[model samples]
Target: MRRVGREEPRAGRAVLPLSLTLVSGILDAVSFLGLGHVFVANMTGNVVVLGMALGGSPDFSTPGCLVALAGFVAGTVVSGRLAGAVPRPPVPALVVESVLLVAATAVAFAGLTPGRRFAAIGLLGLAMGLRTASIRLAGVSDITTTVITSTLAALGARSALAGGDGAGWGRRLGAVLLLLAGAGGGAWLILRWGPGVALVAATGIQAATGGAYAYLSRRRP
Candidate 1:
């Protein structure tokens, strides 16, 4: 395994990306269901919504989608800078992501009026953007945390039917399942309690994931 400061080889690891994929699903569900039908994690969906809105879809908000896209780009830039500055462990980026999620949770509890709801969406988008960028910088594989289209393609290409040994199936399948689980759980929380509860759960999980990574790094010999 390769090591770089506090960072260890994360490629081919299922646990971290699986957990982060779960986080993505939770945030995306909350963003879509609770925050004006926006998508914070999935920019492709957001862009599609923007196009639809421009094509006269009353169900979508063009401004909201644009705001989310902009926020995501900003978050990516910020995360890139953070990673370059730290260049060792990824704890700083993860902590910043958690902070963004926490802010979103606070916005949810504060009530989603006109401005506040959009603010929450932006925050969620920013957090997800940061996470995706950080993961890419860390050189992980078989998981992008938010996007699964490529992962699905990879799985299909390497399946037994495709004359391949089905390598990396566990991580690929686990990512998809975890994402589904997180989305279901987020939706249930939104229906049973409210957005506040779901956001809090997502934030808590994100923080816990970061802490766990940090702990594991310290234990590495």
Candidate 2:
């Protein structure tokens, strides 16, 4: 019974990271497809795109990628400070992220002029950075809530077929699937309605995830 009680809290904690992964996917899709062919959440992709842009690719924007990378870095710095100041780092970090997402959504609704597009990209990149840093501070294992390359690698390397114990396979698989689902849903919504609608949806999911995490933290002993 005691073990079950302990396990329940761990399970509850997993929900927040997984939900954030979905949020990252939606934001990445929206940014890459609608904004300026850059990734806000997945900085790895953003870096590669930036390199491509530097190499004279007309399909990418150098300025947009740079802004996103800078914004993400700034957000991580802010998150580190926030984590040190607050007893519960994730709560405050998530609150800030949610606020930034809301602002990004508002900007998206306003218009996607060249200037506003960069603004939205920077805002999203910053928010994702905050989320990533907070999750790191929380020490959640096997879920990154953003890039899944490492997760995929670990999944393949640790699979029973590879003569290794399938530890963390479930969470890794779920992260991949959720990220895929979020990206697909985000792209569909962008095509059907607009990027603004997609940002609105992403903002709602982010806010809900923050709220759920806060509630769960409060309930945990």
Candidate 3:
């Protein structure tokens, strides 16, 4: 019974991060496909796009990328501070993220005017930044929620094929698959209904994840 009790909470720790990763994928799809070729969650992609824009690529927007990058930085700073001050950082940080996502969804529903597009990009970027920082503070191993490059590298590096005992491969693989699934589903929804619908779905997921995390945290001993 004691071992089972400890293992259950350990298992529960992965839930919030995985759910947030799915939200990241959906937001990335919406921003890249619907917004002006920008990535709100994936800063690595945003940086590359920013460079391309600087290199005179008409397909990307320098200002939009800059806004997202700036927003992400701001969110990280804010959440880092919040994490330092609070006992349970993920709860409040997730609340802030949810609010930002809701605001972004509203901006999307209104219209994607040039101004509104930038606003949505910044809001989504900020929300994702908060999520990244909060999850880092939560100390969940093997999941980053927003980016999965390292997760993939670690998965391959420590696999049995690499002459090492394969540990954590399942969770790493699941993260990769969920990211792919979220992107594909989000893209399909955007194509069929529009970015507004996809944003709504993402926001709902974030809100629900936050609620679930809070509930589970309370239940944990």
Candidate 4:
């Protein structure tokens, strides 16, 4: 299946980006499975779900989908603003992501009852969307946590008949695998540990990543 993650930054390790990818996956899984049948990261799926809901699809929650769509937009906007304002590189980007994720985690944990889908979905979507956007703005290229259409497409083409430099395949594969792991883990957590598990895990990972960045920046700065 064409090994991935070839686009490695000159920095230390790919742990941070890979963690962020998992964050995206977990958020996607929770949003789709536990909170509501919507995707916080994959806006395309969110739109499709929204359309189906509007069309009176069975068991589709219109309110939930609309809420997620709106939250994701808000998150993206917030992330963009943060990236523009914050200094480039170092821990700034991760700082913003960590803050947003922590906030979302609070929301999720506070309302993690069997029926608190609104808070769960809304909070997670807001945080995840913002984190993904932050990754984009930070120039963490080819590590989009949400969707993988272009990445997969490129991987398929480049690793195929074209026979070009496959430097980024490792990173690409890392992103995909991290996401799948997140989704699978999220689904399992939701089914076993409940909705709170997903948000807790996501937030915790982001916070750790942020801390690592901060430490690294200070050491090098």
- Taken over the whole model, the C-alpha lDDT of each candidate is 0.82, 0.86, 0.86, 0.71
Counting clashing residue pairs in each candidate, in order, gives 0, 0, 0, 15
How well does candidate 1 match the true structure, expressed as C-alpha RMSD? 2.4
Model 3, 1-221: lDDT tens per residue?
Answer: 00111222454576877888899999999999999899999999999999999999999999999999999999989888886777677888899999999999999999999999999999998998887877776675558889999999999899999987898888889899989988998999999999999999999999998898777766753
Question: In lDDT terms, how accurate is model 2?
Answer: 0.86
Whole-model lDDT, model 3:
0.86
Q: Model 4, range 139-218, lDDT digits (tens) per residue?
A: 55666767877778877777746787777788888778888899999899989986667778887887887787556545
The local lDDT score (0 to 100) that residue 188 gets in candidate 4 is: 92
Which candidate number would show the highest lDDT if scored against the true structure? 3
Clashing pairs in 2: none
Q: How well is each residue in 74-125 modelled by candidate 1, as lDDT tens digits?
A: 9888877876677543667788889999998998998899799889988888
Task: Supply the TM-score for candidate 3.
Answer: 0.94
Q: Which parts of model 1 are misplaced by more than 4 Å?
A: 1-12
Q: Tell me which of candidates 1 and 3 scores higher on lDDT.
A: 3
RMSD of each: 2.4, 4.0, 4.1, 5.1
Give TM per candidate: 0.93, 0.94, 0.94, 0.83
* Count of clashes in candidate 1: 0
- Worst ten-residue run, lDDT, model 3? 1-10
